[model samples]
Target: MACKERSKGDSRDGDDTWRNTSLAAAPASRELGKAWILKRLVHHAPAIFHSFDFPAFELGNAFEDINVQFTEHGYILVGRSQYEAAEGPAALAPTFAAFKDNLCSVLVVNGLEPVPHETVVESSKTATLHRMKTWRGEGVNLLCGAVMEPTRGILVAQQIADDDRWTYSATSTQRDRMLWFERVYLPCGRKCVARMLLVRRPTGVATSPCAPHWKPRRRGIAATPSSLHRNRLQRRGRDSREDGMLVRVRGKILLY
Candidate 1:
């Protein structure tokens, strides 16, 4: 009987060892994927900008709550908000909640770059293409929308533009939590005069960092560090094993 009990104990220890080993290996893979995503965003942003007419523009010195302009080329508008700079990731949840609340008629569009004129007028019209059709011919106005990924901490928005010809391309660099830099592009005869630049904040953290920030929250407020960390994992599409790892990490932190 004693021998059987010992055997059961050994089996339990072996299972625990395997489980722990698996959990330990997962974070490395997740980190690799995160790095890959950042690299891809960086790689693609320049190609999108190369097609812009005026690649650089001097940003106006005055910071306004909202700036709106109507021109023959298109419309231009930018909105700014102030936040307490020291909160880091803690600020993302509330900020993103506000962002999501404002997305009323917006649909998830593909790629954050200037849509080619031909592509916009394509015959077999994708949903985005179909939407483009409504903007074509005669006096078309600027199209406005928000691309949000609450899970990934990414929110790419266009408040106003000169015309419907321009689109935005984004890259995620993990420096700070909410830094952004934007450059205004003057119109170059309906060929998409895009305002392009690395969005920067006062503190220099470029945030809204990934596509997962758009995932709808699964109830409960994310106010604590554990909850924020959990929300991040959910954004990254964490599996049960990863979830367990987080719980263990939280437990360790609590014990310490």
Candidate 2:
């Protein structure tokens, strides 16, 4: 499922580097899902670049389902196992660091405004790429691929937004991916903070709204995740709570 997004002209060794490298995976939703996945992937680059050991955040079924496909051309990384096997553990930190540095440079210099989420969702195309400034004033590139299937969406993006800098790849399975959508993303609000608050629940906390043990009570009605989400919000009075701080960004009422 992995393929390279290469630029027009490059050396044979560069080509080999593309063959050797790959990226991460993403969520399938337009507004929250696409944005959430992109931010996570951007954060992940730095973590992979700095650490020799594979981080705990990169493990689990949720991450495993996401394959970070690059939009430009350069060397990203393949997978954890393939990377370690082919390049040895020592090559990881330095190689990933190089990729991160290069990508950051491009994003910082050539960035543009973020495309609206509604535009991305409404587009009838295979993919949509947006340009925007990061909070740090660095540039960010956002690419949301179309949801060809109802249950899944793919995203490919880079920070240093150039066509000649980084290579990307992807792989997928239909099974556990659905589990990720159900368990994690379904309970979230319009922004990423909802998931973070949900994750901070204490151990043995069964009442946490996103508790894995909780299930829908409506026996006869088949429910979509969104409906379940609305139910959770209404039932929990999540619309207004001490924990749900009001934030002003994008003219949206984000329940942080």
Candidate 3:
């Protein structure tokens, strides 16, 4: 019997169908603009600092309570709270003042960059799946979700919450993890967008110097100084054995 060919839409399982619908209902135009701007910025950022590692930064209290205000001249003001120990309000006053000064200094040096017109600003309370979709549209191709295992560390699986339904039904495969945000168009105005599934691997397996928790190993192979000398003598014995074999072969040839 011939195997039945599945229809394009039919191939989408329940989870995939959910993701497709959720992505379709999302604010695509806004995400498209944000994705374009982020792509440009990421391309220009130095290799050391260019990354999608928001999770790492998010863990810090400094990032948790950030506030941004746009000035009339288009400069954004970013502020954070100062960590202070109790000595009374008087003791905390200097700390607060210093934090304000630091905030101003940081804004002067780094916050002067112009905001892209299409950027979408959301709070930390925003749904992860929605953020994933938005980021994916912005040309961030990584997929993030929760998984359960024996031990949970910073690398535990992403959890799908009630507020977001897009990532809930998707499978734990690499192909399902990747999202494609960019579309190419021909002169005729027909557009094609590519989507790929990326297989997830344990982190820090590559040659890049930035692998987490890596340490250097000692160079060279030698049991000890004496053992090294002994191995050299053993190699010479093997060489003499080969030379004796060659001499016997020559004698045999002469006799023939």
lDDT of 2 by residue, 1-256 (tens): 1222223362322422211111233233334433444444333332222221222322332221111211122101122211112233344344333423343232222223332222121222343444333333333343433221222122224221231222221121100000001111112221111001001121122211122222222221112234444344345443222121111110121222
Query: Number of the top candidate by TM-score?
Result: 2
Candidate numbers, best TM-score first, in rank order: 2, 1, 3
Reference-based TM-score of each model: 0.21, 0.21, 0.17
- lDDT comparing candidate 3 with the true structure: 0.23
Q: How far out, in Å, is residue 107 in model 2?
A: 15
10 residues in a row with least lDDT, candidate 3: 150-159
Question: Which lDDT tens digits does candidate 3 get at residues 107-222?
Answer: 12112232223222231111122223221122112212221122210110111221232453343211111211111122232322211111112221221212222221122111
Q: In model 2, which runs have C-alpha deviations exceeding 4 angstroms?
A: 1-124, 150-153, 163-256
Better of 2 and 3 by TM-score: 2
Clashes of each: 25, 18, 7
Q: Rate the local accuracy (lDDT) of all candidates.
A: 0.25, 0.25, 0.23
Displacement of the residue 166 alpha carbon in candidate 3, Å? 4.8
Clashes of 2: 18
